[model samples]
Target: MTDTAHALAASHTLWELVGRRAELTPDRPVLLQGDRRLTFGELRGRAERVAAGLYGMGVRPGTVVAWQLPTRIETALLSFALARLGAVQSPVIPFYRHREVGFALRASRAEFFAVPGVWRGFDHTEMARALGAKGVFEAYDDLPDGDPSVLPAPPADGTAVRWVYWTSGTTSDPKGVLHTDRSLIAGGSCLAHALRLSADDVGSMAFPYAHIAGPDYTVMLLLYGFPAVLFEHFALPAALDEYRRHGVTVAGGSTAFYSMFLAEQRRRPGAKVIPTLRLLAGGGAPKPPELYHRVVREMGVQLTHGYGMTEVPMITMGSPDDTAENLATTEGRPPEGMRIRIVDGEVRLRGEAVCQGYLDPAQTAQAFDEEGFLRTGDLGRLTDSGHLVLTGRLKDVIIRKGENISAREIEDLLHRHPAVGDAAVIGLPDAERGERVCAVVEQPPGAPALTLPAVTEYLRGEGLSVHKLPEQLEVVDALPRNETLRKVLKYRLRERFSA
Candidate 1:
């Protein structure tokens, strides 16, 4: 990290970081969207005004405020405004519907709720009203604004739990992950340092800003004094123009994002997809080595994947200076304060970046080990070089005939096949075998149709163990993915294919 960033990282609160960055680079742009730009000075100044506005509405320090809005300049302003007041924030993903939103509002006991009103056809305000949400307000195009003089002092304490983020909740109801300002700062610092970002680099947020990565990426920009383009609704082809317009140097959300860019590049082979694009970096889902090599060779860019969760925003991240072998096979290394432990092959983490705990006391108790390390439930081992090699999740291990089969191992091999665009290996219920291995694949455009026999034959040619071979094959147009990072919804696949 640069000296400026290191110094800025010492700030006790997000509002403090914003103020310091604005003081240092007031003229520099911090956010860009559709010809609109917000400089550091404007960010701090406007956020304070918004804080004053929110204060007028009776939102005081420690007041619980939940917001479900799209990724817009106004959303950041509102969030920072809340931060300025030291109010506890609960950000609900805009993609979430009644059940999730209601659950979050009720769980957090929010005193205020910010919604986009009517966004992308759905009426968020109406839904909030239906759910009997408190302090419902529309903050889509116009946010609350008041004189900065009316605002109270910004937050000083960073260790207090001030943020509640929801897990994807693939299998069950989403868990409310609690985070503090310092934990979020540590997470973003790790990301900014690992990527070796500079002020000259322009980043892009193609995912929902409501996700935990919202703060993670925002802190990186605040530290580095760079700007990132915001995409309210990210889709290929349509969003490509904005990326080109902003000259995004770093673009990625997850492995799925890498694949999306690769697919776009294939549409116009030999031509740079985004001319200014230099690196694709993200971490939410597993990254296949074949995807890494293909990205480097085909897209002509460095692809750095990482290990992160809602609990720990950034556990490990691949460095651009690392070797190709390590970059391709490992999830890089944790920063100085992060400690990684492996017990019975499960990756455990203990670091400042790690969240304090979940909202449920019981869940929090079960999530940590006796040593205070957060039990990740992810199976992985650290290489001799300290790079993390994640094999699979504990629930992802397939038990067929009393033998364990790694779904990630099979999925990684499947990516090498020419016709396979992406694959998800899942265990389906089988009366005889206990659980049958199922390979769900989505073939790339113009690739030959895949069959059960063809896929199994290819895996056999690749030397997959017989027991690990997928007993069932399901070819789909696309795998189910979450809106935030496009992580494949394996639980959905298990639900879909089990029948």
Candidate 2:
């Protein structure tokens, strides 16, 4: 690990690490948004001022402040300022409406709620007011600022619960996952060490800053003293110009991001998508080995995928130095402190990086096992080399003819098909077979249409068992995705195709 990374790993809190990095590399760039830049020194100074401003607004230590804003320099500044004040922060995704946003605000009991006023043609400030949110204010173009001298002493303890991150809540109300500064710092440290990044490496954040990944990625920048391009709105072709302009060495948010880049590369064959991009890495959804091989083979860049959730920002991450087979096939090994225990094929994690638990006591109790490992609810096995190969989720298994089949197993094989752009395997209710396997796919533009028989033949050729073959196939213009990382919403697929 680099000296800075070592220092960061030893630091107790996020603000402490940021301050230390600023002291060491005060002039180094920390954040880049279009033509504007913020250095380490300026980040700390501005955050302190914002901290004073928030403090003046009665945001004392332990105050719950929820902000739903886009990914920008001001958002980062506000988040760090909240950290500086030791306030409990719950960040809602900018695209979320009353259902998710109101749940988060009420659950967190936020004393102050910051919105972007009107963003993407939605009136968030008005919605906040309608929800009866306390201390609602706009924090898009301008953030709160005041004299730093009026602020109280920065919190010294890093173990206190100061962050409440929400789950996607696809099937139910989102859970407020509790976290502390030390846990977030540890998560970031794991990412920094696993990726083998350097100060010269330029990164990019194309996802929502309100997600747990916000702190996870920020921790890496402070540790490595590197800057990452921030994209408030990310899309292909249009976002490609900024990636190339910034010379982003590392880019990607999830499996969807990899597919988007690959699609762009396919559009202009024989030309590099982003001339300077050397690595594409992220986690939040499953990555097919075929996708990894295609990225490395076609894009001429290494692709390292990982395993993480809102409960744990990072669990395992493939390293660039690892063997290609391992990098392509498995989620990389855990760091020194992360303990991965597979109990009955369920992946359980115990580490400082793991979240404390949920805000509700009952949910917290149900989340951890007797030994204190966070029950990941994910089914996976550890290889002899300590790599994690995730199978289907416990709830994602299909039971056809009283036989169990893995959806991920089928999806991975389907990705190998030339006509398949992306695939989501779901099980619909069936009377005779218990639950029937269904394949929903998005084909590449201008590619031959895919049918159920053709998909079955391809899967059979790929060595899939008869029972696991998808009984139904649905081809759509695109797969349904959430706003956060564009993860395939299988529940939405089930809702659409169940009938």
Candidate 3:
């Protein structure tokens, strides 16, 4: 890892961050999959060649390049390669059907797509052909037919767009969220500070690399001189093993991930994990206090809660020393290079961590104030200690005649019921009481049948305000989840109940 002036100039890019990583631990492993592993030096060389190969195909910087490959070393390296060439990486989940993939391709406006003819057992060739995309870089990871070259030259400075992230389209077509080198680098720097990460840490994410959390978190890990392990998915059983195998000290993910693993822990009692494990952090949806309790008390790790979006990946959260209560109650204060304002009880943020906004200027303008604070659609209040406590989504609260109720408070209370495994509170259009409170629930495995009366009784015993209590309760098999497994399309419940 040479200290070229070019590296310093482009220090915010993914490849540049890894260059710093190489200097810190040249002989240490940077990536691991099953039995295979790559040291920093080896990874640097291979990724360089991959970048050069894409360059040879005229894949220039700022190019929106998509991935039709699986979660292999190639997919990871190609993502790095594109960033090195000043190109944007757009990763599509293999689970996405043809129609969904088409939407992503169109929304991202990807000019180049790297696809493996086949991945695992899936035949990607037909899908690639169906894509009808030109400049397709096709290669099979199981075997290499030819050699790739060294890294391509960096893109010119002050490039307008560094990355393109599609908004999770819970309701409609996903809009692309553009990022700059400034935004990406700022994200890395803030994450490093927020988690108090170190070179001794090994960061492994089980989510998709195309995500804001995935790639941005990887950049932070690599910049802090830590190796990052990627799983095809969140393999909880293998995760602890990999943590120990990679000497991993930090773990992070969503609330659902923790809940799933907790269920597994319940299934298999007496399961212990990596001795060096220090931190377990994540936040996508509202996390229950009990979840954090298990992560700290049972899993034997520090639990953290982060608040971010596809635009600004890591914005605010409880740090390592933050109490479990604060982490569960609040989204934490705004991080460095960011600002937070509460107007009419709505959260508004501004600064480098904020997204430049959506691709549409009209939407962007609508998302921000004339003064430039990104008007976040979340409702929250600042505690006397300056911690931010999220009440619920601005649109999720129900106004019953004169009183306002937070759905999150009701949902959290419903979760306390031993019979209710999962819950969502929605405001249904009601001719009476203005908008009535409705609760949708999922029963836990091996739990007794849950009736509406039983749920109402539990809510009442929990001492919820009468107005906050859900007037109607509907039991469902499972809630819908988006790519990251966060329940994004909650409106479905209201639609069903109305029908």
Can you rank all candidates by lDDT, best first? Answer: 1, 2, 3
Looking at model 3, which ten-residue stretch has the lowest summed lDDT? 1-10
Q: Write the per-residue lDDT of candidate 1 for residues 327-367, one digit (tens) a residue.
A: 99999999999999999999999989999999999999999
423, model 2: CA deviation in Å? 0.6
lDDT of 1 at 236: 95
Which RMSD values do the candidates have, in order? 0.9, 0.9, 3.5
Q: Give the number of the best model, judged by lDDT.
A: 1
- Clash counts for the predictions, in order: 0, 0, 3
Q: Clashing residue pairs in candidate 1, if any?
A: none
Select the stronger candidate by TM-score from 1 and 3: 1
Could you tell which candidate, 1 or 3, scores higher by lDDT?
A: 1
Looking at model 3, residue 218 earns an lDDT score of 64
Per-model TM-score on C-alpha atoms:
0.99, 0.99, 0.90
For model 1, give the RMSD to the true fold.
Answer: 0.9
